[model samples]
Target: MDTNDLPFKKRNFANRFFDATVWDDFIYRNDDIVVASYAKAGTTLVQQIVAQLIFNSRDDVDVASISPWIDSVYPDKRSKLNLLEAQTHRRFFKTHLPVDALTFSDRAKYIYIGRDGRDIALSLFDHQNAARQDAPLSADKTPPSASGLKVLAPTQTSACDYFDTWLERDGHPFWPFWENLRSWWQVRMLPNVLFVHYTDLVADTGKQIERIAAFLELPLSEGRLPTILANCSLVSMRANARLYVPHGAGLWKDDGRSFFNKGQNSRWIDVLPPEMSIKFEKKAVMELGIDCARWMMLAGPVANASVG
Candidate 1:
């Protein structure tokens, strides 16, 4: 994959990290909204949620077009700024880069999604494999330069390779999961931005959708709220997956299915080995301060007294 295609801005760890020159035109306007997150963290899932709410739950709109992905790839920097400047009913966009790469528009509201690293590992694995399947392959099913360890394309590798790389200490496309969440977690406390958890969305999509609408201050008619809630559910989103295509700073091909996968959480319990689970848990505790091993304390299988 060509690194130039990524939408990331070049930066050295200095000068407080500002580069408005690249995306000045694409900065948020009064009507613009941002659905941002780390990859495999439900960026598309919440984009659909917001889109449905803004469109008044209309089924006729081309969601993908209405909510363009303004990442480093789609419109590039110049085109992205151009899109940001243009007027529309609302400007909806997706992003996977961390907060440092993003431009904070004081007036624009940002919605960030957070998910478990285990599910992210699984989802990312599937995402990479799907892309590799689309690329031209050798008889043995390897890309041209990726046959050996020398080639380090995310799209050219398997799930295990991606997971290993992601879990490692220092590598390109840095995991930075811990730092990413903490930075945005801080931003979330700001008045304009909202932070959402993926598990909550899965468990109670309806309520989560309502919370989203409330955050955006988008009014929802009584009937429309239910409609948007139903449409944005993982089941509904997966069934209508064809409506969303790949766009962004990555080479995910144009595969629409890439956005909506197994949507279930805690899948690592099924596939992750004992040793790997321990390592992943340790890293999560160290990096995210959440112990996957004992996360059940908050997410037990049993219903709480209120729900029960």
Candidate 2:
């Protein structure tokens, strides 16, 4: 494909949590790795995995600090750019923006992680609750516009209600879930984009890590493999949770450990009613089509696994 022919469309999106406009000022490097996902879709996990691969599985590395969320308005565009510009390593950054809202670069490699929306809804509930708890403390200290931070008020009382709101309203407290998934799914065939699923990662982390490493063309020695796998494990990530939590422990309800809460899938299996589950599945099919929806729901073999 012609580099110039690659799709590029600028858009503006803002909510309490994200400012997609931050990408407007982002400077992309040829070797840059962009990690994109909807909320609570194992974004941090992928970032941890990428950081481990780039750093050759160094346990002490601050993954959160090193892999900054460039689109976050907390530190502002100038501050993020300054930090990114000074980075000597192959830089990887985090974003939750949809494809159109971003400035696409043919040179950069993008890793897009997808999780079942049912699972994401449960995880998002905990995340929002934690943020609400932390909001008051930082409300006076941190300027509102600086972070685009707003304490997310719970729209529903229970997990079932929360899932209903999430699916019906389309990723309430964040952006539209369907659009975000569909936008990235459409670009899965792009050479620079790698599609990852949370279920697949959980099923075989080492295999997924190898896939990621190969996609990024990282030279992995047999000796370094064990360390990389070890560091990216759920236990290790949760144990060293402070280093991986965004904006540090102070911004979380339970001092950041809660941010890494139960990296398990199918939690919604018990929580959501059968009808609600059926509703979500139907919506998924409507938004993402049968192939992508099935792939996303199962997180199994990719339906269209042609991209490098």
Candidate 3:
């Protein structure tokens, strides 16, 4: 299948959090790995996993610096491009943009991670709150561009209020949630694209790691599996937070540890109302169809579930 021929819409996503257009100038290499997610999913976790795989489970790799978020608008485009071009090692990058927003390359491997929207809402709230607090004193607080595109705003502290805003606004301060999932889901069968659910990672990390390794064609020695697994653990990631935290923890008020807060899913079960939870599920079904939605939320078996 020719991915370039796939239908896509060009968007000027210049928001406080993301800029989709930065991808237009990106150059793809045959060995490049693109780690993607809708915000606060397992993007960072999988980045760490991919870093370990590429570096043969080395602990000293600075993933955050090495794996820049290419689509981010904060760092200038030329600098990021130059940094990537200079890299000799197998380059892996992060992006929050959906598949359609990106410049797809058949040669590059893509790993898209998904999580329950409820959990995402909670995690996003924490991330936004911390980011807001970390904002520089002279930072621009002006409204986003006149393109009528809504930038991500500070999330409410109350879980219920935040959930309401997120559900009502369809990812509010961020881009649309359902469309991101649907866009990636439609291309799940692509040879270079892999779909990984957070639930699956939590349930069987070793299995998922092996799957990722196979997808990336990384040679995994049995001896290195333990180190890779340890580095990817929540505790280890938090402890070594400085190396993996985006922008070196300066973007977070409470430091990088707060950004890595509690990797556990379902923190929204008690907080999210039953009706709202049902609404999220129904919306997922409507957008992604029952099979994809079921696999996303429950990590159930899907037909022909090959990793790569």
Q: Using lDDT, give the best candidate's number.
A: 2
Ranking by lDDT: 2, 3, 1
**Candidate 2 per-residue C-alpha lDDT over 114-210 given as tens digits, one digit per residue, 9 for 90 to 100:** 9988889899887777664536457546755464554554344787888798788998756689988888988899899999999989889888988
lDDT of 3 by residue, 1-308 (tens): 58665645466564566667667777888879999888888899999999999888988789889898887765666767889999999999998877767788877889999987788888888776766442543234323331231223355468788888888888875668888888888888888889999988888888999999999999898888899888899988888888888755755555667678777777777677767777777777777887777766663322222310
Q: Estimated TM-score per prediction? A: 0.74, 0.92, 0.88
How high a TM-score does candidate 3 get?
A: 0.88
Q: How many clashes does each candidate structure show, in the order listed?
A: 3, 0, 1
Candidate 1 residue runs with Cα over 4 Å from true position: 1-21, 136-162, 169-175, 248-255, 290-308
lDDT of 1 by residue, 121-146 (tens): 67866765554343333212433422
Model 3 lDDT, full chain set: 0.77
